[model samples]
Target: MARVKKKIRQEQLIEKVKNKPFLTDEELAKQLDVSVQTIRLDRLELGIPELRGRIRKMAENAQNKVKAIQSNEVVGELIDLELGHSGISLLKITEDMVFGKTQIAKGHFMFSQADSLAMAIVDAPMAVTGVANVKYKVPVHVGEKLIAKAEIVKVRGNKYFIWVKTHNETQEVFRAKFIVVSWGEK
Candidate 1:
């Protein structure tokens, strides 16, 4: 019975990590109701790399595909990307990113994350946001991690319409629609 339960737990661990590769061992332990050491051991037995290695592998895959902006210029870490189609980025709000008193993150940081993601998805050598319609759904506090996903909706001539949604761990915190103009290979 113990072996059976261990097998089941290992399967759950694998599924959770497969779906959300960025989850740290601590987070995985919490979600699985297991100790972090157990999680690490399972990961080792399963041949799964640690969170940082997983993220680095993902970033390396997307780095070569980005064309509109330099990898370093992205407001957040670009974890997943498919040029001209969609992409995902992760940004963690820190002390310097939030207001000292309220602890609410500066709005521009969220906007930049979404905007830069929108620009990065354009299938051009270069792209710029000509217009942006955005809404801040809720205030995000420091220590919260934001996951922003961008999708290109339509294209007309040089203009690409992109929609980006930013979410904290719980719910959506921000969204934006952008009109990006692409420049032919620079």
Candidate 2:
């Protein structure tokens, strides 16, 4: 690959991360057709931190807004929340989340993140997940950050139909529709 000018490479890197902060250095290197070391140096020069750091930073900003469940009990960090409407969260897949042989994340982690986000979006005192229809679109690996976005699709009486879709930078990893029973509906 012809060498991308340092300035152009930095600009592209910034834009890439702007679009998806969860991208790893290796992924960025592959996307930009540059060496990983070059990518690292470019990130450093551009005042960008490593992938995990970036994820933590993004999650830190929104983690405190969680209401339905205690922040620690939720599977992921609650980054954005608008009760009775929509919300977003972040989950970082770790070694413990993956199977030993395949290195693919266990399914429960994704479900937990989605389910919690679904419950969090209900604007009631008590929210319970009555039924979940979920699908795993792709296998996730360790060190990947998942951004889960949840929207309240419908509300009938005390029941909220919520949709959650989790994705990495390039593709969807998990999607689910949750029927949540909000006990304290006005």
Candidate 3:
């Protein structure tokens, strides 16, 4: 069999995202007709962190609420909470929620949504990320609303471990465990 041509380079993918009004790994993958993982790998090789990560970094640097709020890209509202320890966020996944071909929104999107809520509960000025492990259970289609409930599972020293469960239309669809480090004047 003859040899096949190589795919596009990482730089090319970055350029594509930079040119698009709304850049996402999934959208990029769909446009390129490649797998989401492929796009992730390309981003990694090019030293481009995930969108959520970038947003977190920006939030950390902001000096005021306006700048900080601008860092949030997820769409949702805080329904219930218990300040300074744990809380829950409710969100609806619409057609616009889709980042790529995946129906359940990007992993980073969920992570960010949960992270922001966790931060709010802690009432911290800035938080640093430590670790996160997420499991996708079902596909979240367009028009399906989801509720992501997160709570502080454990706190050791300055590290806070948060557990998040996502429900879609009365069904559990995703779950995640995150470790966050908060730095603020006490």
Candidate 4:
């Protein structure tokens, strides 16, 4: 009976990680109602890497596909990319990114994350932002994770229109529309 339960729990663990690969061992343990050590052991048995390993694999795969900019130039960790179409990035708000008293993240950090994501989706050797229309919908605090997604809306000549929306865990915090110009090829 105990072995059967363990097998079932392991199956649940696999499914949970598949649905959300970024979950940490502590989070997984909480969700599974098991100890952190048990979660780690089960992950080993199931041949699953930890959260950082999983993120590194994702970043490596996405970085190889980037063309407009070097992967390291991305303002956040580039996790998904389809050149000329769409891309996604993740940013964690740290102490240095927020105001000293307000504890609210600086707007430039969010804009940079969105703008860079928009630039990355352009399939060109050189891409530069021509215009940016942005709005900060809500304030984000330190220790929060931000996910920015960018999509190309239209293309004309060497100009690309892209939209980026950034969300914290609970709600959308920022949005932008970018006009990008790209030329030549590397």
TM-score of each: 0.80, 0.67, 0.56, 0.76
Weakest 10 consecutive residues of candidate 3 by summed lDDT: 62-71
Best by TM-score: 1
Pairwise TM-score winner, candidates 1 and 2: 1
Q: For each predicted model, how many residue pairs clash, with residues at least 3 apart or on different chains?
A: 0, 0, 1, 0
Taking the tens digit of each residue's C-alpha lDDT, what string does model 4 give over 1-186?
A: 999999999999999998788789999999999999999999899999999998888788889988888888999899988788998899999999998989899999999999989988899998999999999999999899999999999999999999999999889999999999999954
lDDT (Cα, tens digit) per residue for candidate 3, span 1-186? 111222445556777765542357887788777799988887787777787664344334331332112334323655445544555556766666677656656655566677676565554556766888888888677777677777887888778888888887658888888787877664
Off by over 4 Å in 4: 1-20, 23-48
Question: Which candidate tops lDDT?
Answer: 4
Poorly placed runs, candidate 2 (over 4 Å)? 1-65
Off by over 4 Å in 1: 1-16, 24-42
lDDT of 1 at 50: 97
Descending-lDDT candidate ranking: 4, 1, 2, 3
lDDT value, residue 52 of candidate 2 = 81
Pairs that collide, model 2: none
lDDT of each: 0.92, 0.85, 0.64, 0.92
Residue 132, model 2: lDDT of: 99
